[model samples]
Target: MPRTDTASRVITAPLDRVWDALVDPAALAVWLPPAGMTGRFERFDARPGGSYRLVLTYADASGAPGKATADSDIVEARFVDIVPGVRVVQAVDFVSDDPANAGTMTMTWQVTAVAAGTRVDIVATDVPDGITAEDHAEGLASSLANLAAHTER
Candidate 1:
Protein backbone atom coordinates (compact mmCIF):
# COMPACT_ATOMS: atom_id res chain seq x y z
CA MET A 1 0.00 0.00 0.00
CA PRO A 2 1.02 3.59 -0.55
CA ARG A 3 2.01 5.72 2.41
CA THR A 4 1.52 9.27 3.63
CA ASP A 5 4.00 11.44 5.45
CA THR A 6 3.68 14.86 7.06
CA ALA A 7 5.72 17.59 8.62
CA SER A 8 4.95 21.04 9.98
CA ARG A 9 6.68 24.04 11.41
CA VAL A 10 5.88 27.50 12.66
CA ILE A 11 7.87 30.08 10.77
CA THR A 12 8.42 33.40 12.44
CA ALA A 13 7.28 35.36 9.44
CA PRO A 14 4.09 36.84 8.16
CA LEU A 15 1.78 34.61 6.18
CA ASP A 16 2.13 36.65 3.02
CA ARG A 17 5.90 36.43 3.08
CA VAL A 18 5.81 32.72 3.63
CA TRP A 19 3.30 32.35 0.81
CA ASP A 20 5.49 34.34 -1.51
CA ALA A 21 8.44 32.08 -0.78
CA LEU A 22 6.31 29.10 -1.68
CA VAL A 23 5.45 30.45 -5.12
CA ASP A 24 8.70 32.04 -6.09
CA PRO A 25 10.84 29.70 -8.15
CA ALA A 26 14.08 31.28 -7.08
CA ALA A 27 13.17 30.99 -3.43
CA LEU A 28 12.12 27.40 -3.95
CA ALA A 29 15.41 26.55 -5.57
CA VAL A 30 17.11 27.75 -2.42
CA TRP A 31 14.79 26.18 0.15
CA LEU A 32 13.21 23.10 -1.37
CA PRO A 33 16.26 20.84 -1.29
CA PRO A 34 17.10 18.97 1.89
CA ALA A 35 20.18 19.38 4.06
CA GLY A 36 22.66 17.49 1.90
CA MET A 37 21.14 18.25 -1.47
CA THR A 38 21.28 21.12 -3.92
CA GLY A 39 18.47 21.75 -6.33
CA ARG A 40 17.79 23.61 -9.55
CA PHE A 41 14.66 24.04 -11.53
CA GLU A 42 14.86 23.18 -15.20
CA ARG A 43 11.45 24.73 -15.88
CA PHE A 44 8.83 26.19 -13.62
CA ASP A 45 5.26 27.48 -13.92
CA ALA A 46 3.27 28.07 -10.76
CA ARG A 47 -0.25 28.15 -12.12
CA PRO A 48 -2.89 25.47 -11.92
CA GLY A 49 -2.30 22.82 -14.54
CA GLY A 50 1.20 24.19 -15.11
CA SER A 51 4.31 22.14 -14.42
CA TYR A 52 7.91 22.24 -13.31
CA ARG A 53 10.96 20.01 -13.41
CA LEU A 54 13.31 20.04 -10.44
CA VAL A 55 16.66 18.35 -10.29
CA LEU A 56 18.24 17.67 -6.89
CA THR A 57 21.83 16.57 -6.61
CA TYR A 58 23.36 15.03 -3.55
CA ALA A 59 26.42 16.69 -2.18
CA ASP A 60 27.82 13.28 -1.30
CA ALA A 61 27.05 10.28 -3.48
CA SER A 62 28.65 7.52 -1.44
CA GLY A 63 25.38 5.89 -0.45
CA ALA A 64 22.68 4.34 -2.60
CA PRO A 65 22.22 5.68 -6.09
CA GLY A 66 19.65 8.41 -6.43
CA LYS A 67 16.27 7.73 -7.94
CA ALA A 68 17.06 9.31 -11.30
CA THR A 69 20.82 8.96 -11.45
CA ALA A 70 23.89 8.10 -9.45
CA ASP A 71 23.72 11.40 -7.56
CA SER A 72 20.49 13.07 -8.64
CA ASP A 73 16.79 12.88 -8.08
CA ILE A 74 14.63 14.43 -10.77
CA VAL A 75 11.06 15.36 -10.06
CA GLU A 76 8.41 16.19 -12.64
CA ALA A 77 5.53 17.89 -10.97
CA ARG A 78 2.31 19.59 -11.96
CA PHE A 79 0.48 22.25 -10.03
CA VAL A 80 -2.86 20.75 -9.16
CA ASP A 81 -4.27 23.58 -7.11
CA ILE A 82 -3.11 26.95 -5.88
CA VAL A 83 -5.00 28.81 -3.22
CA PRO A 84 -3.17 32.06 -2.77
CA GLY A 85 -1.70 32.49 0.72
CA VAL A 86 -3.53 29.40 1.90
CA ARG A 87 -2.41 26.28 0.09
CA VAL A 88 -0.64 24.75 -2.86
CA VAL A 89 -1.12 21.19 -4.08
CA GLN A 90 1.02 19.32 -6.55
CA ALA A 91 1.10 16.01 -8.31
CA VAL A 92 4.67 14.75 -8.35
CA ASP A 93 6.48 11.87 -10.00
CA PHE A 94 10.08 10.87 -9.95
CA VAL A 95 11.86 10.48 -13.23
CA SER A 96 13.40 7.10 -12.65
CA ASP A 97 13.58 3.71 -14.28
CA ASP A 98 13.33 1.90 -10.94
CA PRO A 99 9.98 0.23 -10.50
CA ALA A 100 9.94 0.94 -6.80
CA ASN A 101 9.95 4.68 -7.49
CA ALA A 102 7.32 4.74 -10.19
CA GLY A 103 4.14 6.43 -9.01
CA THR A 104 2.39 9.76 -8.66
CA MET A 105 2.51 11.45 -5.27
CA THR A 106 0.33 14.28 -4.14
CA MET A 107 1.99 16.97 -2.08
CA THR A 108 0.01 19.62 -0.27
CA TRP A 109 1.48 22.70 1.34
CA GLN A 110 -0.83 24.62 3.64
CA VAL A 111 -0.21 27.71 5.71
CA THR A 112 -2.21 29.08 8.56
CA ALA A 113 -1.85 32.21 10.62
CA VAL A 114 -0.66 31.51 14.12
CA ALA A 115 0.07 33.52 17.23
CA ALA A 116 3.80 33.70 16.59
CA GLY A 117 3.71 33.55 12.82
CA THR A 118 2.59 31.25 10.04
CA ARG A 119 2.26 27.52 10.54
CA VAL A 120 3.34 25.71 7.42
CA ASP A 121 2.17 22.14 7.02
CA ILE A 122 3.24 19.73 4.33
CA VAL A 123 1.57 16.45 3.55
CA ALA A 124 2.74 13.94 0.99
CA THR A 125 0.52 11.06 -0.02
CA ASP A 126 0.97 7.97 -2.13
CA VAL A 127 4.66 8.08 -1.53
CA PRO A 128 6.65 5.66 -3.60
CA ASP A 129 7.92 2.59 -1.82
CA GLY A 130 11.54 3.37 -2.58
CA ILE A 131 11.43 6.36 -0.22
CA THR A 132 11.63 5.25 3.37
CA ALA A 133 9.52 6.96 6.00
CA GLU A 134 12.50 8.01 8.10
CA ASP A 135 14.25 9.59 5.15
CA HIS A 136 11.13 11.35 3.96
CA ALA A 137 10.51 12.75 7.42
CA GLU A 138 14.02 14.08 7.64
CA GLY A 139 13.79 15.60 4.18
CA LEU A 140 10.49 17.27 5.02
CA ALA A 141 11.85 18.73 8.23
CA SER A 142 14.95 19.96 6.49
CA SER A 143 12.92 21.62 3.78
CA LEU A 144 10.70 23.25 6.39
CA ALA A 145 13.74 24.64 8.19
CA ASN A 146 15.06 25.94 4.91
CA LEU A 147 11.72 27.55 4.13
CA ALA A 148 11.64 29.20 7.52
CA ALA A 149 15.11 30.57 7.03
CA HIS A 150 14.31 31.83 3.56
CA THR A 151 11.10 33.60 4.56
CA GLU A 152 12.19 34.88 7.96
CA ARG A 153 14.99 36.79 6.35
Candidate 2:
Protein backbone atom coordinates (compact mmCIF):
# COMPACT_ATOMS: atom_id res chain seq x y z
CA MET A 1 0.00 0.00 0.00
CA PRO A 2 1.11 3.55 -0.67
CA ARG A 3 1.85 5.88 2.26
CA THR A 4 1.40 9.52 3.07
CA ASP A 5 3.69 11.87 4.96
CA THR A 6 3.23 15.46 6.01
CA ALA A 7 5.11 18.35 7.54
CA SER A 8 4.33 21.95 8.34
CA ARG A 9 6.03 25.08 9.59
CA VAL A 10 5.23 28.68 10.34
CA ILE A 11 7.56 31.12 8.65
CA THR A 12 8.18 34.62 9.84
CA ALA A 13 7.32 36.06 6.48
CA PRO A 14 4.33 37.31 4.59
CA LEU A 15 2.14 34.98 2.55
CA ASP A 16 3.46 36.31 -0.73
CA ARG A 17 7.07 35.97 0.31
CA VAL A 18 6.53 32.44 1.50
CA TRP A 19 4.70 31.59 -1.67
CA ASP A 20 7.50 33.08 -3.75
CA ALA A 21 10.02 30.98 -1.94
CA LEU A 22 8.00 27.93 -2.83
CA VAL A 23 7.62 28.63 -6.54
CA ASP A 24 10.88 30.29 -7.46
CA PRO A 25 13.30 27.75 -8.83
CA ALA A 26 16.30 29.42 -7.30
CA ALA A 27 14.71 29.48 -3.89
CA LEU A 28 13.65 25.89 -4.29
CA ALA A 29 17.18 24.85 -5.21
CA VAL A 30 18.32 26.39 -1.98
CA TRP A 31 15.63 25.05 0.35
CA LEU A 32 14.10 21.92 -1.14
CA PRO A 33 16.86 19.46 -0.32
CA PRO A 34 16.88 17.80 3.06
CA ALA A 35 19.77 17.85 5.49
CA GLY A 36 22.88 16.10 4.23
CA MET A 37 21.81 16.81 0.64
CA THR A 38 22.05 19.61 -1.88
CA GLY A 39 19.82 20.08 -4.92
CA ARG A 40 20.03 21.68 -8.33
CA PHE A 41 17.46 21.97 -11.06
CA GLU A 42 18.32 21.01 -14.59
CA ARG A 43 15.06 22.38 -15.90
CA PHE A 44 12.26 24.29 -14.21
CA ASP A 45 8.99 25.59 -15.58
CA ALA A 46 6.77 26.86 -12.82
CA ARG A 47 3.31 26.62 -14.30
CA PRO A 48 0.42 24.26 -14.46
CA GLY A 49 1.20 21.41 -16.87
CA GLY A 50 4.89 22.32 -16.82
CA SER A 51 7.66 20.12 -15.43
CA TYR A 52 11.12 20.09 -13.91
CA ARG A 53 14.02 17.80 -13.28
CA LEU A 54 15.91 18.12 -10.03
CA VAL A 55 19.00 16.36 -8.84
CA LEU A 56 19.75 16.08 -5.15
CA THR A 57 23.18 14.87 -4.17
CA TYR A 58 24.18 13.52 -0.82
CA ALA A 59 26.91 15.41 0.95
CA ASP A 60 28.54 12.24 2.17
CA ALA A 61 29.07 9.77 -0.61
CA SER A 62 29.47 6.95 1.86
CA GLY A 63 25.89 7.34 3.01
CA ALA A 64 23.05 5.31 1.60
CA PRO A 65 23.09 5.07 -2.16
CA GLY A 66 20.72 7.31 -4.01
CA LYS A 67 17.80 6.08 -6.10
CA ALA A 68 19.23 7.30 -9.38
CA THR A 69 22.96 7.23 -8.81
CA ALA A 70 25.55 6.48 -6.22
CA ASP A 71 25.26 9.92 -4.63
CA SER A 72 22.29 11.58 -6.27
CA ASP A 73 18.55 11.33 -6.38
CA ILE A 74 16.98 12.51 -9.61
CA VAL A 75 13.38 13.58 -9.45
CA GLU A 76 11.05 14.34 -12.32
CA ALA A 77 8.06 16.40 -11.33
CA ARG A 78 5.10 17.89 -13.15
CA PHE A 79 3.18 20.90 -11.95
CA VAL A 80 -0.37 19.70 -11.46
CA ASP A 81 -1.80 22.93 -10.12
CA ILE A 82 -0.60 26.36 -9.16
CA VAL A 83 -2.69 28.81 -7.17
CA PRO A 84 -0.65 31.87 -6.51
CA GLY A 85 -0.23 32.65 -2.78
CA VAL A 86 -2.42 29.72 -1.90
CA ARG A 87 -1.34 26.31 -3.08
CA VAL A 88 0.84 24.33 -5.47
CA VAL A 89 0.42 20.70 -6.35
CA GLN A 90 2.89 18.40 -8.10
CA ALA A 91 3.14 14.87 -9.42
CA VAL A 92 6.58 13.49 -8.69
CA ASP A 93 8.57 10.42 -9.58
CA PHE A 94 12.06 9.27 -8.81
CA VAL A 95 14.46 7.85 -11.37
CA SER A 96 15.33 4.50 -9.97
CA ASP A 97 15.88 0.93 -11.07
CA ASP A 98 14.31 -0.53 -7.97
CA PRO A 99 10.76 -1.69 -8.42
CA ALA A 100 9.83 -0.68 -4.89
CA ASN A 101 10.54 2.95 -5.76
CA ALA A 102 8.64 3.07 -9.00
CA GLY A 103 5.56 5.20 -8.42
CA THR A 104 4.16 8.67 -8.82
CA MET A 105 3.73 10.72 -5.65
CA THR A 106 1.48 13.67 -5.26
CA MET A 107 2.90 16.58 -3.29
CA THR A 108 0.71 19.41 -2.17
CA TRP A 109 2.04 22.63 -0.74
CA GLN A 110 -0.41 25.00 0.88
CA VAL A 111 0.27 28.36 2.45
CA THR A 112 -1.98 30.56 4.54
CA ALA A 113 -1.70 33.82 6.39
CA VAL A 114 -1.45 33.47 10.13
CA ALA A 115 -1.07 35.72 13.14
CA ALA A 116 2.68 35.79 13.19
CA GLY A 117 3.45 34.97 9.59
CA THR A 118 2.66 32.44 6.90
CA ARG A 119 1.87 28.85 7.64
CA VAL A 120 3.23 26.31 5.14
CA ASP A 121 1.87 22.83 4.94
CA ILE A 122 3.25 19.98 2.83
CA VAL A 123 1.44 16.77 2.13
CA ALA A 124 3.02 13.91 0.18
CA THR A 125 0.77 11.05 -0.82
CA ASP A 126 1.38 7.72 -2.56
CA VAL A 127 4.90 7.55 -1.26
CA PRO A 128 6.86 4.59 -2.53
CA ASP A 129 7.66 1.72 -0.24
CA GLY A 130 11.38 2.06 -0.69
CA ILE A 131 11.34 5.25 1.33
CA THR A 132 10.99 4.28 4.94
CA ALA A 133 8.52 6.18 7.11
CA GLU A 134 11.09 7.45 9.60
CA ASP A 135 13.42 8.65 6.88
CA HIS A 136 10.64 10.36 4.98
CA ALA A 137 9.46 12.11 8.13
CA GLU A 138 12.95 13.31 8.90
CA GLY A 139 13.49 14.49 5.34
CA LEU A 140 10.19 16.34 5.32
CA ALA A 141 11.02 18.04 8.61
CA SER A 142 14.43 18.98 7.34
CA SER A 143 13.06 20.50 4.15
CA LEU A 144 10.43 22.43 6.06
CA ALA A 145 13.08 23.79 8.39
CA ASN A 146 15.16 24.80 5.41
CA LEU A 147 12.20 26.59 3.85
CA ALA A 148 11.49 28.43 7.07
CA ALA A 149 15.09 29.52 7.37
CA HIS A 150 15.22 30.64 3.76
CA THR A 151 11.93 32.54 3.77
CA GLU A 152 12.17 34.09 7.21
CA ARG A 153 15.36 35.85 6.30
Candidate 3:
Protein backbone atom coordinates (compact mmCIF):
# COMPACT_ATOMS: atom_id res chain seq x y z
CA MET A 1 0.00 0.00 0.00
CA PRO A 2 1.13 3.52 -0.75
CA ARG A 3 1.83 5.70 2.26
CA THR A 4 1.00 9.35 2.76
CA ASP A 5 2.75 11.91 4.90
CA THR A 6 1.70 15.40 5.86
CA ALA A 7 3.43 18.16 7.73
CA SER A 8 2.78 21.80 8.45
CA ARG A 9 4.56 24.74 9.97
CA VAL A 10 3.96 28.43 10.52
CA ILE A 11 6.60 30.71 9.14
CA THR A 12 7.03 34.29 10.29
CA ALA A 13 7.01 35.54 6.75
CA PRO A 14 4.66 36.81 4.11
CA LEU A 15 2.98 34.48 1.64
CA ASP A 16 4.81 35.95 -1.32
CA ARG A 17 8.17 35.42 0.30
CA VAL A 18 7.28 31.88 1.27
CA TRP A 19 6.08 31.17 -2.24
CA ASP A 20 9.31 32.51 -3.66
CA ALA A 21 11.32 30.33 -1.33
CA LEU A 22 9.31 27.34 -2.43
CA VAL A 23 10.06 27.86 -6.11
CA ASP A 24 13.43 29.54 -6.14
CA PRO A 25 16.36 27.13 -6.39
CA ALA A 26 18.85 29.28 -4.51
CA ALA A 27 16.34 30.08 -1.84
CA LEU A 28 15.34 26.44 -1.47
CA ALA A 29 18.98 25.39 -1.16
CA VAL A 30 19.32 27.76 1.76
CA TRP A 31 16.56 25.91 3.57
CA LEU A 32 15.42 22.23 3.21
CA PRO A 33 17.91 20.61 5.50
CA PRO A 34 18.87 17.14 6.45
CA ALA A 35 21.97 19.00 7.62
CA GLY A 36 24.64 19.83 5.05
CA MET A 37 22.17 19.24 2.25
CA THR A 38 22.06 21.35 -0.92
CA GLY A 39 19.47 21.53 -3.69
CA ARG A 40 20.04 22.07 -7.39
CA PHE A 41 17.08 22.82 -9.60
CA GLU A 42 17.43 21.54 -13.15
CA ARG A 43 14.16 22.91 -14.47
CA PHE A 44 11.37 24.70 -12.64
CA ASP A 45 8.56 25.98 -14.78
CA ALA A 46 6.13 26.50 -11.85
CA ARG A 47 3.30 26.13 -14.28
CA PRO A 48 1.48 23.14 -15.72
CA GLY A 49 3.72 20.76 -17.65
CA GLY A 50 6.69 22.36 -15.92
CA SER A 51 9.49 20.11 -14.67
CA TYR A 52 11.62 20.24 -11.53
CA ARG A 53 14.66 18.35 -10.26
CA LEU A 54 16.55 18.70 -6.99
CA VAL A 55 19.54 17.04 -5.34
CA LEU A 56 19.95 16.66 -1.59
CA THR A 57 23.08 15.56 0.20
CA TYR A 58 23.56 15.15 3.89
CA ALA A 59 24.78 12.93 6.67
CA ASP A 60 22.49 10.44 8.33
CA ALA A 61 21.56 10.81 11.99
CA SER A 62 23.92 7.97 12.80
CA GLY A 63 26.79 9.99 11.28
CA ALA A 64 26.69 8.13 7.98
CA PRO A 65 26.40 10.14 4.76
CA GLY A 66 23.42 9.76 2.46
CA LYS A 67 21.38 11.49 -0.21
CA ALA A 68 17.70 11.88 -1.06
CA THR A 69 17.44 13.16 -4.60
CA ALA A 70 14.47 13.47 -6.92
CA ASP A 71 13.85 14.47 -10.49
CA SER A 72 10.47 15.35 -11.91
CA ASP A 73 11.64 15.41 -15.50
CA ILE A 74 8.15 15.90 -16.90
CA VAL A 75 6.03 17.44 -14.20
CA GLU A 76 2.28 17.41 -14.64
CA ALA A 77 2.01 20.16 -12.05
CA ARG A 78 -0.61 22.75 -12.68
CA PHE A 79 -2.35 25.56 -10.89
CA VAL A 80 -5.41 23.39 -10.64
CA ASP A 81 -6.70 25.86 -8.09
CA ILE A 82 -5.35 28.98 -6.44
CA VAL A 83 -6.43 31.48 -3.85
CA PRO A 84 -3.89 34.24 -4.22
CA GLY A 85 -2.00 34.07 -0.90
CA VAL A 86 -4.11 31.29 0.46
CA ARG A 87 -3.58 27.98 -1.28
CA VAL A 88 -2.18 26.15 -4.31
CA VAL A 89 -2.62 22.66 -5.72
CA GLN A 90 -0.01 21.07 -7.91
CA ALA A 91 0.82 17.58 -9.13
CA VAL A 92 4.33 16.38 -8.24
CA ASP A 93 6.27 13.29 -9.16
CA PHE A 94 9.64 11.85 -8.25
CA VAL A 95 12.02 9.76 -10.31
CA SER A 96 14.58 7.84 -8.33
CA ASP A 97 17.37 5.43 -9.20
CA ASP A 98 16.03 2.95 -6.66
CA PRO A 99 14.06 0.24 -8.41
CA ALA A 100 11.71 -0.12 -5.48
CA ASN A 101 10.62 3.48 -5.96
CA ALA A 102 10.11 4.26 -9.60
CA GLY A 103 6.74 5.92 -10.01
CA THR A 104 4.90 9.21 -9.98
CA MET A 105 3.61 10.76 -6.78
CA THR A 106 1.17 13.59 -6.26
CA MET A 107 2.03 16.27 -3.77
CA THR A 108 0.17 19.37 -2.71
CA TRP A 109 1.42 22.34 -0.75
CA GLN A 110 -1.10 24.61 0.88
CA VAL A 111 -0.32 28.00 2.35
CA THR A 112 -2.57 29.94 4.65
CA ALA A 113 -1.94 33.30 6.24
CA VAL A 114 -2.66 33.50 9.93
CA ALA A 115 -2.36 36.20 12.58
CA ALA A 116 0.94 34.79 13.78
CA GLY A 117 2.33 33.86 10.36
CA THR A 118 1.83 31.74 7.31
CA ARG A 119 0.83 28.11 7.80
CA VAL A 120 2.37 25.86 5.16
CA ASP A 121 0.86 22.43 4.66
CA ILE A 122 2.55 19.72 2.62
CA VAL A 123 0.93 16.45 1.64
CA ALA A 124 2.72 13.72 -0.28
CA THR A 125 1.29 10.45 -1.56
CA ASP A 126 2.59 7.28 -3.16
CA VAL A 127 5.59 7.04 -0.88
CA PRO A 128 7.71 3.94 -1.43
CA ASP A 129 6.65 0.90 0.60
CA GLY A 130 9.88 0.40 2.51
CA ILE A 131 10.05 3.99 3.72
CA THR A 132 8.16 4.66 6.91
CA ALA A 133 5.59 7.43 7.10
CA GLU A 134 6.98 8.77 10.37
CA ASP A 135 10.40 9.25 8.86
CA HIS A 136 8.97 11.20 5.96
CA ALA A 137 6.94 13.32 8.34
CA GLU A 138 9.97 14.12 10.43
CA GLY A 139 12.06 14.93 7.39
CA LEU A 140 9.38 17.28 6.06
CA ALA A 141 8.95 19.02 9.38
CA SER A 142 12.68 19.42 9.71
CA SER A 143 12.83 20.96 6.27
CA LEU A 144 9.98 23.30 7.15
CA ALA A 145 11.73 24.42 10.29
CA ASN A 146 14.88 25.02 8.29
CA LEU A 147 12.86 26.99 5.79
CA ALA A 148 11.37 29.09 8.55
CA ALA A 149 14.82 29.87 9.85
CA HIS A 150 16.12 30.67 6.39
CA THR A 151 13.32 33.13 5.72
CA GLU A 152 13.54 34.67 9.17
CA ARG A 153 17.18 35.49 8.58
Question: What's the residue-level lDDT of 85 in candidate 1?
Answer: 91
Q: Which of 1 and 3 is the better model by lDDT? A: 1
**Model 1 regions more than 4 Å off:** none
- RMSD, candidate 3, Å: 4.1
Which tens-of-lDDT digit does each residue in 1-153 have in candidate 2?
999999888888999988998899999999999999999999999999999999999998686789999999999999999999899999999999998889999999999999999998989999999999999999999998999888887
Best by lDDT: 1
In the range 5-119, model 3's lDDT, one tens digit per residue, is 8889889988788877776668866785444455556555555455556555543324432323331122223444445555656554444455545555566777877887788
Tell me the RMSD of model 2 versus the true structure: 0.7
lDDT value, residue 73 of candidate 1: 98
Model 1, span 51-146: residue lDDT tens: 999999999978757899999999999999999999999999999999999999999999999999999999999999999999999999999999
- Judged by TM-score, which candidate is best? 1
As for TM-score, the candidate ahead, 1 or 2, is 1
Ranking by lDDT: 1, 2, 3
User: Alpha carbon lDDT of residue 4, candidate 1?
Assistant: 97
TM-score for all models, in order of appearance: 0.98, 0.98, 0.76
Q: What TM-score number comes out for model 2?
A: 0.98
